[model samples]
Target: MNTLQKWLGPVLFCTCLGGGLTLGWSATTDLNKKRSSEVAVLQNALYDQECGSCHFAYQPGWLPARSWDKIMTGLKDHFGENATLAAEPQRQLTDWLRVHAADHAQGGKIQKMVRSIPAQATPIRITEIPYFQKEHRKLPLRTWKENPQVRSLSHCATCHPQAKEGSFDEHAVRIPNFGPWKD
Candidate 1:
């Protein structure tokens, strides 16, 4: 090949490669920034009054939108309780949950939670998550059965006092009768 043709091909290839690298890096940086945002709190008063009345109004960022949709539609059989809501309130809660669901939420915790589950899995409870299970698996059975304060892992606030505020920092964990969580 002629010198001009050979040099031109290499130049074009390098330019395209550099451009691709720059775009990829920019996208990764943006995602990292979103994932590193300060802890987000569930601020919806209506959600607090409606869902929180029965149980901890779980942070929407813990599960995917599909899971929320399934739970919202199946409230009549919600963990064996009649949690049926009026159409209007149901719509509002569903909307709120969908907007803040794990797949859409920003933060490393949310991203990791989302990644831990299969794309098709529709987990109604955070405790059903593999990541959550693995994290809590170290705890003995007594913590769930014998411990009066912690009857179930579903009771997030039992150990994580800041759960209502949407914070689950390991450093903040305090188990009843067991003292602070180590590791």
Candidate 2:
């Protein structure tokens, strides 16, 4: 009826709406940060022992289930080495890897890695993933070849000190002789 009375209702509604939106935005942003920060750490002891014995026990989230399946099936000639496991352990590792692979991931860098691959592509090597290549494109070939401490990009832990822990944050990288990466 009067100017003050008429304006109060709309003012209160607008204030409540804005406050709700602010809170919602804050919550969403935090969730996204948590998701995007890292992939899941290697949790299977058998995988860690069997794979880590020869190379970095790369988190399964780096590749899709199809890729993991391919890799598991080809362990006899794994990257020019015979990495064949016994029947039981091999089956168990394959199952675990597929379950946690990128395609099945909820969110985070793992999901981004999955999205980078073509739907038809089944890349057995994590280094072959488009996302992995893009992220490492800035590095010179010498870093992987000449650096005694970092002989290959496949050696994720050589630069990503926390790769085992599933933390691939660029800020934490220490590229052996090359030092900290900045890009």
Candidate 3:
């Protein structure tokens, strides 16, 4: 084939692939939103308990089923904080958490999170995502004045409504009374 024909075929293939990927991400985000809704319902049932109070599960599927198992068993010393959960309650939650943990290979939430994480020596928490940092980086000092809901950095869903959808695009974020985003 001529040079023009060869280039045209390859370019068209790439263009189609790129478009497909973008569409896939959009669909996946929608799925995440739906799944997040279920998890949120589960969260509400645990009103007496505050598992997600300090920490976050931006990508709940990031850890393996076994990881949540380990954490559930040691609630008192949970990663340092006292995440102590009662025995019966823990059993219920442990099963629920494991069920939602990421299991897929390509678009699995847990796999995506693990890949995004740096291979640094330090341990990492899901709350420390770059998007999370960018959103809350300027709030440490001012966080005190905010309402109780927005006080914690884990409340990404409060400001960014699409957070549960995995839409961390800064342009799509709405930071409370701050209005639309600058970035």
Best candidate according to lDDT: 2
Q: Give the TM-score of candidate 3.
A: 0.48
Ranking by TM-score: 2, 1, 3
Q: What's model 2's lDDT at 15?
A: 100
Worst 10 residues of 3 by lDDT: 36-45
- lDDT by residue for model 3 (1-183), tens: 699997998999999999999999999897766554222223335522456556444444545555566667767786677767677777777787677654443443334554554554222344654433444566544532465546655566776676655555557766665656564
lDDT of 3 at 142: 50
* lDDT string, candidate 2, 83-181, tens digits: 889999999999998888788666667877889999989988888889889998988878777788888889888888887777889999998888889
Clashing pairs in 1: none
Model 1 worst lDDT window (10 residues): 31-40
What does the lDDT read for residue 60 in candidate 2? Answer: 82
TM for every model, in the order presented, reads 0.77, 0.78, 0.48
**Candidate 2 local lDDT, residue 124:** 86
lDDT (C-alpha, whole model) for all candidates: 0.84, 0.85, 0.57
Q: Candidate 3: where is the Cα deviation over 4 Å? A: 1-59, 78-81, 103-105, 108-111, 118-124, 129-152, 162-171
